[model samples]
Target: MLEQHATELLRHTVEETFPLAREVMTLDARQYTCPERFAQEKQQIFSRVPLVLAASCELRKPGDFKTVEVAGIPVLLVRNREGTVHALLNACTHRGAAVASGCGSAARFTCPYHGWTFAQDGDLVGIASSTDFGAVDKTALAMKRFPVTERAGLIWVILDPDSSHDPADMLGGIDELVAGFGFAGWNHIESRTMHGPNWKLTFDAHLEFYHVPVLHRETFGPERSNRAFYFSQGPHQRVVAPRGRPGDTAKDDLYALGRLPAADEPFDPLLVGEWILFPGASINTFYLNGQRGVLLSIVLPGPDVGTSTTTQTFLAETPPDEVTRAAMEELCTFLARVVGDEDLPTSALQQKALATGLLEHVRFGQNEGGLQHFHRWLDDLLKADDAELAALLAEPCPQR
Candidate 1:
């Protein structure tokens, strides 16, 4: 975040502490309910734009790899023996069967269909029954690769092979703001997937703190203010909530941390709140048993507008001690309850209501600038003309 932006937000926070009427934003219901729009989004926005695919820590070392699907395209990400990351189509060169699934450290991957093997760099190294199968150029058959750029301990990939946009152009130096979080040194603890309705609804929930006092009442508690300070780089954004209550007497373990930070200590506020790495990923802070933890929220869009998936990854700055490990486990369980019990269930109901078409559009308050900015960015891409769209795609897309 720029110093000017930070100061401006602080000023707003101070002013908004009172009961002031703020401008509100209207959002269309079909944005979440229409299948045709979803399909278009899958093609024009999701496929063409550079998305934050994973935290660089997910591939910790040489030969470490993870597989994910983006815009319904199977992606294989690997760090080669020389420590470079490769993002390639997970399809096998032989028959298009995925050569890998999940995460692990593997010297090479072999297609299960016919046992064709490839190294981490997608080099075809072995082919079974060569005499009978005939000879082909192995180099020509390397797994189809995608455009992948890495910066600030994060990996971004464009799902469309033909798209030439750079992820750094999407980031536009926003990485410098949160690079201080030490994500590069964070150790990935665990990942669990859950189903949700509409990627936008789920993402919208993460972008604002407005629902905290109500929806998260049992989790975040009512005393905490339901407000957020917004900072964005292009379509990517970061929402900062107040770090902790200085003099409160509540035991609110928000972020699923079993305890709160000592309010007396001089602390940095920017590192304290939620960061949305847009398209799908959030970096949130947590402190459990006195050890720092980061909750990496990766939102995976499902086959249609009606469904979506979320991958919540827990990370620690260092390997946790037994006590800290136990605290983390407890935090994980609490997070499951909060999301599965509170968040997604409500989003599913919201989806159901939106599908009724009774409401044409909903509103977002002035404080919800992040959500407004996101929708506007989406609309711009979806509504751009031929030449305008091409030029938009070619340039850096950090939102003003």
Candidate 2:
């Protein structure tokens, strides 16, 4: 399935043809500006759907853990001694205070506020002052645990503790291609968060490359392709440009495949593009000084309707040397500028305009199939109940 998509892209590139959707679509602008709608999205979509919180390599060893907040819910991801990953509510059972923050190795978390301790598996192992605090059932006071699954080198967690939905089902067939990347063995370099506009507004830019040439002219350059071909597997999508800047490493590598005498094997380089994990995450291929790398961007909605934070994690296929490390650092800095100065600033302005009630609808052109699919899925997910939502995701992905 992965190689077949690569072949399709190669064919499109050779034919100089990219398919477009049947018609343009319009979405209610208020979906991006209304507080009531944002609240529903938080509960229905953000809370219900499985979210990609970290790559498997981020917690490769037992006792490694990372903490992140999704839709205001603090989540702690940990790996136990037996090499199993678990997701727990970051709050301590004692007084709802967070037992951990940031990422590091720890056998147990001792809450700073009261000294309550929790094992990596969320077991309430120790109480600060057993006699003074009084006797209680430690079993009943265990940290809240959420359903979590690790697959295709990524870790997915459902914020809802009782959710019956399988996190793997949400990936659709995207895991096939992601597994090809062998991200489980990749080295985690660095991660940083950047503040942005509304979650939807910030994520909208990642679904389409229409504004790439104009918005990213200074960074990606004006010669870069403004057109892209979107392929979907369930709610996840890949933004593939049939053609792009001539000097782009991935593009050059892809075009070079056509020159080969016999292209029997799947050329891994051809699979390079932007792969978006639904709700809010994207993995974009990159090469630093000839070393393969990917930028995994996860966007989570903030406390209010008009704010979001994107955590960008850079990973390399192997440990980076000094030269490769320098290149990776340079690339990250450049991307920060491209997204912070260009993409997000534009989205923020759009949010401001939409908030004024001047525009009732936002139009997505036929070429913007990715955005159309995303908005449609979001609407459906928002309307679905627990059973309906599971049934919706369980349905097979539509064939392109």
- Please give the CA lDDT of all the candidate structures: 0.77, 0.85
CA displacement after TM-score superposition, residue 329 of candidate 2 (Å) = 1.1
What is candidate 1's lDDT per residue for 354-389, written digit by digit as tens? 999998998888778778878888888787653455
RMSD of each: 4.5, 1.9
Candidate 1, which segments miss by more than 4 Å at Cα?
9-22, 246-267, 384-400
The C-alpha stretches of model 2 lying farther than 4 A from their native spots are 259-267
User: How badly does each model clash, as a count of residue pairs?
Assistant: 2, 0
Which 10 residues in a row give candidate 1 its minimum summed lDDT?
249-258
lDDT of 2 by residue, 88-174 (tens): 999998889999899999999888899999999999999977999999999898899998888889998889887777777765656
